[model samples]
Target: MKKGSLLFVFILLLSSIAASIGFAQEIGKDKLFVAALGDSITFGYNLQEDKTKPSSQAFPYLINEGNAEVANISFPGWTSSQLLGALSNQETLLALQQADVITLNIGSNDYLQAIGLQELIENQTPIEFTPELQQKIAAASAQLSQNLQNILQTIRQNNQTAPVVFYNMYNPFGASEDPFLLSLHQAGEQITLTVNQQVLNPIAAASGSLLVDTYSAFSGNQAAFIIPGDIHPNAAGHQVLGALADQALASLVPAAPTVEIVFSTTEKTEGPVKVTVTADQDVLEMKWLPGEQTADKFSAAGNVINGNTFDVPENGTYTVYVKTQEQLEAVKTFKIENIVSKEEEEPPAEEEPPVEEPPAEEPPAQEEPPKEEEPAEEQPVTEQPQEETPVNETEKEERTSVKEESTTPVVTVKKNELPDTATAAYNYTAAGAVMIMIGAGTMLFRRRRARVN
Candidate 1:
């Protein structure tokens, strides 16, 4: 062959190989493998392990539902420093190789610890204000910001082609007045915002990467998103994250296709209890049997179901059968275990009757004169004056002689039947008796007075 003909053949071969490579790249782009790296919040910490399905509201699960395969490498309490350390490990490198999309959330812990350091310095200082401590805080904040930048740089080095999305730190403490904790939280917020805008955004913009703004979504709403006394997001918070993931993934993937089995729980006894069924897509009609059930029991509060609260009324083996759009069927079984009810325990019955020592013997009784004693003395005095001259001694003698002379009952004079003259005589005798008493009293009083003198 001529030299020009040989060169033309070589050029044609090179063109064909280039076309094939381009087609391969296109095909690879159709599918995605996502990996999440960071702390407990990225792991969906409070979410149940069994319930952490691809349908979960966590961002990874949401991305998977959008047709990407996802893996979560987040551990509780991991900081940017730790995450960078992990990237140097073989396992993390392998994971990075497999990941087409990477979501990173870190640096919050570092910011938190820096705040702790600030507090420690403040406590150690006796002065209310210290310029040295302030300088230290500023230095620490700058270091933290730089550490986050380094983390993003490391990720870029590992996966140059992958679209990296850096999630900004959220304000975990909302509207709190606790100065130390609040200052820490505010510092984290400000530092993260700066890092995202000045560092992460520019890098992403230059490299054609994606940036997911989680900070704005959960900023002031920290109280609503985080579990009380915990650093992790609650169910509703997961839902918010899932929604954001849905939006982010939509830009990268085609609309997702979903098949769900919805059922209402009525008088559930031992499930697999029968449940009413419905479907979003006409793939399968759901049914319940005595022993067979699978696919999660959709809850009223879950992303899918609206009216039913899925519950296992009693412990038993249950299975759910799902029929595909092609009329093919699949079934899965779940064991329902007994859940202990929360109830107050009854206190033990009163052991023995409280021992009662006979009420301490009352002090010996002291006798008290009758309340009517003075009244009784006054009554006798009044009666003596009125009866001063009741019948003379001669009348008394005559009555006794009459009683002796006759066998009949003796006739006694009645004091009440005395005549008017007898009454006048009684009064005169009373006056004489009173005069005598006065004379005796005066004589006694004069003798006492003489002694006193």
Candidate 2:
């Protein structure tokens, strides 16, 4: 073949492979993934008063600016060291590996620890500024800086280009104005600033990360953002953070994966349909749900045992959706009407026809040679012929010949047409042996190919 012809053929092959293997990939994209890591602020601490799940208004929950998945591992009261420990967890590590955007908020508790303060802001407490406390502050500051550096390194090991946003800590004690408490608050604010500017900011800049200044967002309005006398943000504060994160993530949204479901009737009944969604061989962790449905329909809300296909046995209208790989990507629903169950179907029983009575075998008609007319014998009526003398051997033989001429011929069958059982058994045995040989050959060929691979 000429060089141009070979090149054209190769190009066609490449196109065909891409079309088949990446069926869910639209022109050029996959789902966007966002990973949120750190403390109470990112956890939406006081946003949900009644539930453990984060409020819908939480920043992590609101990070979805497009086709996106969010993994929120934030916990309340977590210090920089605590977060550094959490990075070793398999779930957190896996989420980082797949992240397109990551938000980090830590070291706030470390700052609080530096001052040796409990969870309280007292107005009348006296200040005893000692050298021992100053040493504690310095040590806490050093630990916070090291942990922050390590956290960034751990995340960078898994991902290179994801935009990691570092949230600078906000001071929540502006409402306390007693002389001693006011001085303590000032020191706390300065500690937070030192960590943000000296520890977090430079690394973020060097790593091409975004630094969101939460201090400015809550600086003048700390009482409104923070819960009364508590460090956690309120619902309104969560909203502010969510909006900030959303604005930061506006440019990183990628195209979502789409799935096409092809269905086939499992039986002639057509009520039970087999719904198929293609997936990569390595894919695991799938969640299924009925995305759209009639009120009367039974919902399909669980993982399917089979990899890509599910047998929908309900007789109602619905669309089932599937999410794969930590619920990062999902395709539109696979629609189905009545899917029938094959086991429930039975073919109608056939009625045997009434047997006919065979006609009785008729006796063969007896045919004797028509009686020959006897020659007139007037003398026999008058008198019997004189008795013959005792017959000799030759005369007996003549009498047997006369009797043989008067006997009738009998009919008989020529041959029977019944099948030969031996011949039929031999033919079946030969066919079975041939099939066994073919099957054995096929299995051996498959085993050899497997070994070679």
Candidate 3:
């Protein structure tokens, strides 16, 4: 019984030592604890379907390629004031306290609000940014500066040791070729530069935070970095930004190894296109989506196909998403302007039957001589007209005399009083004659009797 107790106590001592060693190693680990906070740029808008969650292609995910612990607390359409208000939350304060590196990019929405940004993006109309509005934005910028300073102070109070990397704004619409957008582009660029130069630079310097010059990095290259119709950075742009942030934190934590992804397409620009992705790391899987979009976890949100080659029946933008064995993802976009449809390619075969068979079959019908017998079949019609001709001729003669009979005036006199009066007179004369004859016959009879006596 004594030996059994000693053995148990010896086992407990080793277990306690192992626990202590594990805790020490965990505390001494060099992996970074990154906290991402800001607006839609850090939240990765348009990169995925769900706006409430950060995308896998966001800068936080790209920074260590999911190697370090990251907490993305950014939201879309958040202004500097809102971020300042959020710093008082217990959960936000806790995350900041545990962070070894914190990335911040706010104040874009504060300036965009003056130019009707939401209406402009939805309606696609140019922002006026009139002189009065410019003055208003300038006044608002002063307030924004104060808000940013307060936000930094709160973050510093929560996390005194972590390096805060603040990114300035970039003019995503500056490269637009539209004439109406030109004014907006200019005004936006000027405000962005002013904010970066006067506001962010001084605050970052005073707060002992690192200022990442995103404006200079994205100067005329917005077409490559920004999403086509949106103001957020694309997958490639996020990767570049992540690299910049990683460079800023290099002194404290080692930068992650770079994964090289090379994507190319077939020589033909339009039909039956082929895309090939070659990387230094082993490729795990890839997905294809139409238009421009980044990859998410397991290539979710079906936009493109699931293969490397495509023979689609459309002509537009297509994006290819590739994932490596190390769980790193990359995206590439290609523009296909023309697509030759199968119907168009088979038109010659379809036309051959009509072109050849119609002529060959129609000649026999034309040479049949059946049309000559058609007139013979019409002979009964002529016979039928001949039978009715004598009746028609009698009718025509009667019709011809009707006008002459009507114009003669004999019928008119008979219709008037002359015929009636003539008839009456003839009747009277006949009656008188008859009466005289009767009287003469009676006298002759009497004279003959006297002569006889």
Candidate 4:
């Protein structure tokens, strides 16, 4: 071959390899799976199911569109401790482990419940303070903090590479000067702030975890966004929250090379399994990083390059991390050993018993004699002479006439009584007449004296 032809062939080979790398990196683009774990707020209470879609909100939706998946496992009345318990459960842990993004909106219920207990204490009979109740509140708050910490720890243990976002509680109680309301809110706020500062912030800083601030977001617009007569946000409120989640996710996972990777298994395992991966940008290669037990046991088929699978070897715990062509990494964990197979247990055998015979019927009893009928008694009657009465139409007419006459007199008296304006007018007229008389008398006396002089 000529030198020019050989150089062209080499260039073509380089272009093809570059194209393949770019295709691999674009996997799992615009797709995301998220597990939203929290109370009613995280569940988007009163929010339409479709409205909770990632494409609806700017924040969470943005993150969702970025090849992320979300699974909302939020319970309405769940507290932080309840969430911790739920997350620690084998089933919840397995389900949550599959998520690329995990968002938590707990602690509000804890604070709310605590405040309720305080109210109950305040309203107690005999006005006696109990050391036990005080201790309970303090203990609950402490446990809440600890539970939040434990939840973060569990997530980290299961999926260290997945970005775990903790959203701080918003002010459920709006700005009110009422002492009781204020005090309750203060208690809740204290717990919330403490958790964010002492527990969540520390965990995030230490382990590269993400923190989303929902407290400040809802504080300013509490009246407009918050649901009427309830602490949960309305539709507009969810929108605001979703926006915050989106921003948090974006910051947590910036635009980078991504690849979609899927695993094929003969039977579904208790899985945090990879279903698919689509590339978003250019990259050199792609590979599945399997868990400890599943590693090096399975191989890829078709266009799936460098794919692998593993059986969840143990019941206790496990973690798996994935590496992309651009070196961007994501991790998920599963508790495979805890899943029970229904086919393994055997059914109990049926048993039969002998039947008992029925007893014979008894004979009827003898009839009783009929009693004699009593004769009806007649009622006694008495007659008395009626007295005659005389009609007095004339007396009746006189009484009616008297009443009419009295009413006429009363009407005349009321008419004769002077009104306030009339009384004042009469007094003014009398005073004017007296002044005229005095002036005339003085003038006449003065004229007589002048004539005499």
Residues 33-74 of candidate 4 have per-residue lDDT tens digits of 666778877766655556443223323443443344556677
Ranking of all predicted structures according to lDDT, beginning with the best and ending with the worst: 3, 2, 1, 4
TM-score of 4: 0.44
The TM-score values for the models, in the order shown, are 0.42, 0.46, 0.48, 0.44
**Which residue runs does candidate 2 get wrong by more than 4 Å?**
1-31, 50-53, 65-68, 119-129, 175-177, 250-453
Could you give candidate 1's per-residue lDDT for residues 108-193 as a string of tens digits? Answer: 66655654644554574222225654565466556655565555555555655555555655666565677765655655566667
Off by over 4 Å in 4: 1-28, 48-69, 88-90, 117-137, 177-188, 254-453
Stretches of candidate 1 exceeding 4 Å from the true structure: 1-31, 48-58, 64-68, 117-158, 176-207, 252-453
Better of 2 and 3 by TM-score: 3
Best by TM-score: 3
lDDT-best of 1 and 3: 3
User: Weakest 10 consecutive residues, lDDT, candidate 2?
Assistant: 19-28
Q: Candidate 2 on 1-453: residue-level lDDT in tens?
A: 456435543543343333223222321345557788888777777766754665556677665433556788778888988998999999899999877677888878786766656733443454355788677767887787667667776776676556676777787767466776686567657766776677667655544456677887988787787787677888777767767766654434433345566778634564556677765423444444555543223234455546677776666444544444523354455455445455766789998999999999999977664554454543422223232234466754554344334355634334465423233334444456566667778889999999999
lDDT against the true structure, each candidate: 0.56, 0.63, 0.67, 0.56
Q: Residue 280 deviation, candidate 1, in Å?
A: 34
